[model samples]
Target chain A: MSDPIFTAENVKQHYLIRQGMFADPIVLRAVDGASFVLNRGRTLAVVGESGCGKSTLARMVTMIEDPTEGRMTIDGSEILPGAASRDAVLRSRVQIVFQDPYGSLNPRQTIGKTLMEPLLINRKDVPAQERERRAREMLDLVGLRPEYFDRYPHMFSGGQRQRIAVARALMLDPEVLVLDEPVSALDLSIQSQILNLLVDLQDRLGLAYLFISHDLSVVRHVANEVMVMYLGKPVEQGPKDAVFAAPRHPYTKALMSATPTADPSRRQERIKLSGELPSPMAVPPGCPFHPRCWRASDRCRKDMPTLEGDAHRFACFNPIEA
Target chain B: MTEITETPATATGPAHPSPLREFWQYFSDNRGAVAGLVVFAAFFLVAVFAPLIAPYPPHEQFRDHLLQPPFWQPGGTLQFPLGTDPLGRDMLSRLIFGARYSFFIGMVVVSIASFFGVVIGVIAGFAPSWLDTLIMRLMDIVLSFPSLLLALVLVAVLGPSLMNAMIAIAVVLQPHFVRLTRAAVLSERPKDYVTAAKVAGAKPGRLMFVTVLPNCLAPIIVQAALSFSSAILDAAALGFLGMGAQPPTPEWGTMLAESREFILRAWWVVTFPGLCILFAVLAINLMGDGLRDALDPKLKRS
Candidate 1:
């Protein structure tokens, strides 16, 4: 098989925040030791709660935040944080779509201007006529009429705005799209429409998607692979079907049980985990999920378990049997 | 056809009115702002055609008509309809000529201050390092002094003159633009659109000026209008203090200063000039308020 489109090796992003004048600074390990590989034409969903560092990982992939350690390679080219000198050409290969469609678009800019911005910035050689042609084509590809190009963002509904945002991201013809909860703010009906559109676009373009969302059901529909994160560490990762059907890690089981099922007949007893997410500044020793894991033992609290497996990998000493 | 149905839906569908027409609609709705617009237009026209409109040259004195009340008063003549100042210059003519000074000073000071302040603010807010710290600290030091006092001190040092007073006031006003723009840039810097712009391969300069600056303009514009009136007021204060527009000049503030002694006898001398200042400032302020309401999208009616 050919190489994956994107590869990250043990990426780590740490921030030192001073508590007070008299207190010592604490280190926030927002994304600590995360490694993953994403190939073309596949979706890798990073599932976690609000502060599990999923967004930070998206930032790393988009090169918005420089990792303190580790390395990332896009299309076999190494790129470093704060080193924009590396390759401007490689930078355009990856683009991100933010969560808030309203806030993600410049209100002052027309839809045509917003869509053409990436083309104008990245491809200076393209003529103005060609850029406009491509912008119209993108607008059509995203299910928006060509006339909508002249209107501003406020002229469109939430779902239509997100379609415009999607079109804008695709204007550069990027190979990888890092969608940061692209549909979380939309209505349920709108969410399904956008998801179907994304699937159709991915099939046509053969694009890789780094889908970051907290909704497990949404992930189940869109993702081929799943990586469960807790307190900035990946606890389990595997094919979506395998991981969802037979979860090895206790945290994954808890998460799966918490997801609401549409069919009442398939509804299972919900597993309620105790306590809130611990502060990333002071992560618990050993297994990060030990405080909340029902199967956590004295051994689980003494030594950290490393992720191990060929097709399915999980970081837990006591695994649930299939 | 789908296209035929879609066209009208897109045109009159949402609350997305054409920006220019929407601005006019909002502006015309406010009675005070409409009045202000009329007053400002009249003042602007008077300033532009001062030489043509004024019956006598601003400095030309009519010895017989000194302290003349007005055309409606017992001793007033139609030639000097508004009246004559203590210097015997036509009060109506000087007031017309004085509009030129007020408008010119306001525009010059605001333009210079806004340009420099916005440039510095965009840099400081976007860079966010030692440069940001240094620029903000300098702005803090400048802002520590009261605006009028700082202008007074600068005028004293620069040697008092109209041009010097304008320069002093611009110096006092530039920091406000810096603070305003910096605060705006700081808030807009972390917005998702800005990040999306960066990921789209926009360089820092383009992001700061094109993507971020346009979004920050509504507040800046409202501030500019409000500051225009303040600039005129500051210039008048300097003229009144004898630090701006020296003797023989018929600036409104200087006319008031010259007529203070005879105010009880000839009320028109100080009252007309004072009313000129009051009306001009009031009109501009009302227009500024209306602009603030019009530009904000949140305040728009669905």
Candidate 2:
């Protein structure tokens, strides 16, 4: 058992979008309710489709946006909905690596400046020479050369820039790092390199990671725990080996079956999900995934099921047999 | 994780030329631009050392050489090289001094316009929707009036003077910078780098001025160069209308106005001052085109 450093209880982010001048504003539940505890030295992977609010979850944890409704406890410091303080004390404990390395970095800033920005903004006590030293140290930690410090973001390739991004995130010595599709923008060969660097950084720093990605294969390699989401709500969540071995929720099963493997001799049936994700503006009556779930019965359409079971939790009326 | 061995993709990219050299490479690619730059440089130097370069005082008259033709002509002398105006003031000396006024007008007007425009624009871009709308609509209102008419009105209100003319021109030209900067800021504000800065504990002020502003500079730089030439033109127009630099100021436009009756007789006063204004505006516009080509990455041919 690991120590829980940050625990988010029933966190929700609902955006109010006004369609027209006369019509009433619609509430778009981007992240309906996600409750999970991030423990020390462990990676919790939030796996979902394009608009399942994985990035929203990461944004909430990284303090980019305040949650519409939630109670987050990070090391005794409480964060409430719409009242999340701009206090650097709590913010300095968490950092983020955004997707698109080219876009995430300030083009005008040099690598050293990018790495040093977090400290400059947050840690006022750190001296200039010490900040430079720490920045150079993190660069080497992320497998970049010392001379790359003075270079601009446009000069580096996707992989090198991702390395720089990772290095920049670690400058504040954050306890938690929210990695939002950290390698989704990189090449296939470069993805593994960044992944390895992330794993190495986690081990050395003992950092808790909230890794958000749609890629299952990458998630399987990095995550200790997995949370499968569909339409802003978690469908299944459990230990990495258990969820992959036996996905109880229909949505989770479909997602797990979709993960492509390179084995030719072993045959597996791919799960085909019909139709596109429904518009978040108008969700169905009962269970959000009921329309898409194969085991959808009359009961499932009327009443939504709560997440059950002790270790491997699932939210489904009729779950698949493990 | 196994040892990953692969050189970064951009490592092979044509040995990274310094940014200045790269800019020059693109700038010099256009032969017209190089010629324009050379001509602009000569004008700049002439402006800088006007007193030393000119043959005589710009205001000093040579009554003996009144209405004289160029030195190449029969009646002309080397002392009055480009010939004399209706008042016997040397056209060459006045034209040299006129360069200094043009540079001053352009610099002051552009600086004032861009500084206020960028500040207001950046604030508008980062402001709430209502504020942004209010600022944009106000700018639109300013743009609705014919620019020269608006400038003339401002100059008239301020009472005809050089400083007042420059200020009027700046106010008239400000809408362009505001529109340009606001557009740039609107596009660049939602970018990931700014978001990253916010996540890294950057305050709103820091995000607006430091993080987002620098990335939105390329377009503004191009717009600034184009505006610089226009500012000079507007100032000249004001001077021509007697709402700018007053009588005997040696301003190109004032010179043209003073020698208006001499157009048929002297020819040198009108022709020389008109040529100075024409060549200066042309050269600056050419350099601005070069700036647009070099600064805007999309317009650069692969």
Candidate 3:
């Protein structure tokens, strides 16, 4: 259970956005210090508000773009900056499933061609028939039928298209998959089906998953461990049960209360936090979430707090205990 | 095109129409496009069968028929229905043969312009900011010149002839396609499919030409159609300017050029050729409109 298949150490992705021709560029710290280790057959859900650098982190782990700073490794191979371009074997070890299934798969390509693309591009040594065979096998593994082999993506519904996207990610037999809001675009009924398909695939293959989502309910349903992020940095990290049961950070507690529960008879205290998330360009000087935190102290406003604690960890000067 | 794989292959479902069939369905809905198609089809057959259907050879001179009026005119004879040029060449036969030249010119010019334009544009779109800026600035320089004048200068340097004229037109027209393709590629480059391809380890060339290029094709196709008609117009303009197909080649514009002086005396000499160019260009423009309506999904009615 403790065997790790993927790891990232203090990963930071900063983008310099130019203001104008004469103005100096401001750096957007998209993913400012993300560290996590994923065990095989387990899922790590990263929950954050929109623009909290969730997708940026997914891009880093998937090796779509190298992190501006820090280290990432998949199946023990260290993913150095620009190494994905030079060393494809290391890149192919991890794949990504995107949020918009409609946008992720090539509209021009047929479903089988879409599935076969990873193999075609990476495993050129494999014969055409072999590639076709493996692709069809993957379609079945993703719970799609055999007849979908030649149809374009527009013909399928959102859930089916997402299944195709998942199938494409699995085509190369990657040890890890970065699911970037994989179910957010899907209908509520369809979401559970796709989630079940993902869980089944994970169980059968023992693949590690870095699931990114803003929806706390979906995270609770699929994740073994959860990391709550605010303003491009993780505010709290722990096992899903522990974090969901007792969120130590102010931001995490606010996020958790916003999630609706099924128990109609039970009265729930929805913690209404004030102030919207600050723009990443002008993040506050001290604690990033201090502006919205009810328990903010003068010390919290003066000095940035580092993530501190044991198995259950949070970054706050004056913290709440559960 | 098999049935969609995700759905169960039940024979009861409506069959997905072929893309061509669907395109035709949408295209035929535009009545003006269909009418254009009919007119263009008749014109195409005339061009294809010019040698067999034309009563007289395109260049054959009936010396007595010089500047003869059309068959409807008082002195006109049925032998030359649309009348003759100053050279006594049958206007009908010459117009028929001229269609062939126009078609040939349009095909060649569009092919040459689009091939180079798409290639360069995709490169520019995929290239880093510095290289992209450099390529676009160069395209801008080319586009800054009035197309016909630039083509005239190019043909002047290349020496006036049919092939050289086409080469000039293609060079002049290439910038439009390049701008179009680059715009399309820029929009498409950020799409998730392109990122997926990159994540799959597709090389840069494959990503540009194979993955990104296909998605950009709808706009390119519309541009190509529009460019097709313009190519003909430009070629005819060049021919009229004596920078394109030379005399006695039966080109419509050259026919107009040959009879420029005779226009006041013998209206048929210029009128027939002018009408031919107008109708040909008009029909193609209508077809291009239809293509745009069909290819752009946003324009499709619910």
Candidate 4:
């Protein structure tokens, strides 16, 4: 009923690949025509193979890279493309938690300084003492001892560092958090802890999450909705329950079947697709996923499939029956 | 996902060794580095109290005692323990006074070079475009010349004074810092933390200076230490060539120059100033090596 906290319409990001002095520059569409809306307290998990533009989409959401084409509205305010044109207020509304725990936090900065930076930068009116108090509070909120504030990033374990990263993102009380594979780099045991922390944080703060990951099991636990991307384009999107139970697009069905299950006896029939992912620079003409898609037909090769339907939108000439 | 056990948060208090203490522990492990540090501290103290500690005023030459050997030798006295220069200035006194020149030049040149170099380098790296191209091109042109040669030219143009020599040495050293900082900034610019800072509404200046500059400091600090010694060497070289710290100034390089004619007869005149230069440079270089090893994250103790 209420307006979504974040909305993207036909977003596209293309990077110019220059081969040499003579060759014409090729346009590599890293994220092509991705459309989604995420409401407050909801998680939109973007699942795709490596180089499927999931991270690029996250970059667009975080406003680190502007979409070459499309309109993105954060909390009903539009985000412009150029560096100078970017709205600082809207930027403060959305923050990102990066993948590598070691690389994400500045190694030279103490945890207290790292956590206090966003607050100092975004909330300039806040006094230094107040900021310090808030940083200590955030450290406690993220399950870290306040005394750890003086410690540098290297002192913390990977999971603890990720928690610090999440805390830093929440320092400005942003409406949205773009998590780009936040737990993919962690060990299996630590993965669940971070996911639980994320879920708990989202529940407490009512924050929208654009969760980008290649790990389906992790997505299944954290995501309310799922969007499947192929190459650079989305092929399927729907509520997580419906999508996981009955994946409509052939690509989504294949992905769901490929996900490893704990019990061997409960394994479903595997649908392995053939061939490596088509290069984004030279994508198939009609359907981006056609080269590797088993269900791809002449019609699928001749014309692109547009997403249709209200609740469970999918783009495929031959979608699986629910 | 449901089997999450809360790991009890351990308070990181006095029980945990601080990074400074850890650094010291590692630093103290290297005997050569500790010796270098002690030697450097001795030189620093001598430089600071050269006037009070030296047996005689640096310029108060003992014409009668000219060319005296060390105190251990026949002609040397306790008052002129290191003996007198060709100018009859106390060798020990002049050597003590010369420490101030070496240390002063090293500190001043490195400070000036690093400040300007880091500012320009960071700006060029963060705002890469025509501005970067222009700055880099200018640096390339400057770098193409041999650093000492460029210093020579600058000193020539500036007319051979202590201040001129300092400025010339700084000019010679600026390109190195610029390149070092630019390379560091360029690498750090694309890192995820930089992007995260941008997403968190950090302005260009804050992102470059606050987020990125601190990360680039380790290499810069190491380069600064190494450059300090080089600055001292270059200043001494200029003084030797009669372009810096002219007559009666008691600079080590001038002492060496003045004593060259008397070297065959009065060995202490040239030898002591030369040894002073050697020890000061060696101590600084060793300390710099230790710092590089200590600050290097890859070498951190497991």
Which candidate leads in lDDT?
A: 3
Pairs clashing in candidate 4? none
Where does candidate 2 clash, by residue pair?
none
Residue A180 lDDT in candidate 2: 96
Candidate 1 on A1-322: residue-level lDDT in tens? 3348999999999999998888989999999898898889999999998999999999989888889999999888788666542456777788889999989999879999999998898788999999999999998898887778777777677888898899998988889999999999999978888898898899999899999999999999999999999899888989899999999999889998998888999869899999999999999999999999889999889899988897789999999996
Q: Name the docking class for model 2.
A: medium
Alpha-carbon lDDT, every model? 0.87, 0.87, 0.89, 0.86
Q: Using TM-score, give the best candidate's number.
A: 1
Candidate 3's residue-wise lDDT over B211-296, tens digit each?
99988888888788788889988999999999999998999888888889887899988888889888988888788788777765
Error of 4 at B73 (Å): 2.6
- Fnat for model 1 comes to 0.63
Error of 4 at A215 (Å): 0.8
Error of 1 at B66 (Å): 1.4
Runs in model 3 lying further than 4 Å from the true structure: B1-31, B292-302
Ranking by DockQ: 2, 1, 4, 3
Where is the poorest 10-residue window by lDDT in model 4 chain B? Answer: B4-13
Q: Of the candidates shown, which would achieve the greatest DockQ relative to the real structure?
A: 2
**Which of 3 and 4 is ahead in DockQ?**
4
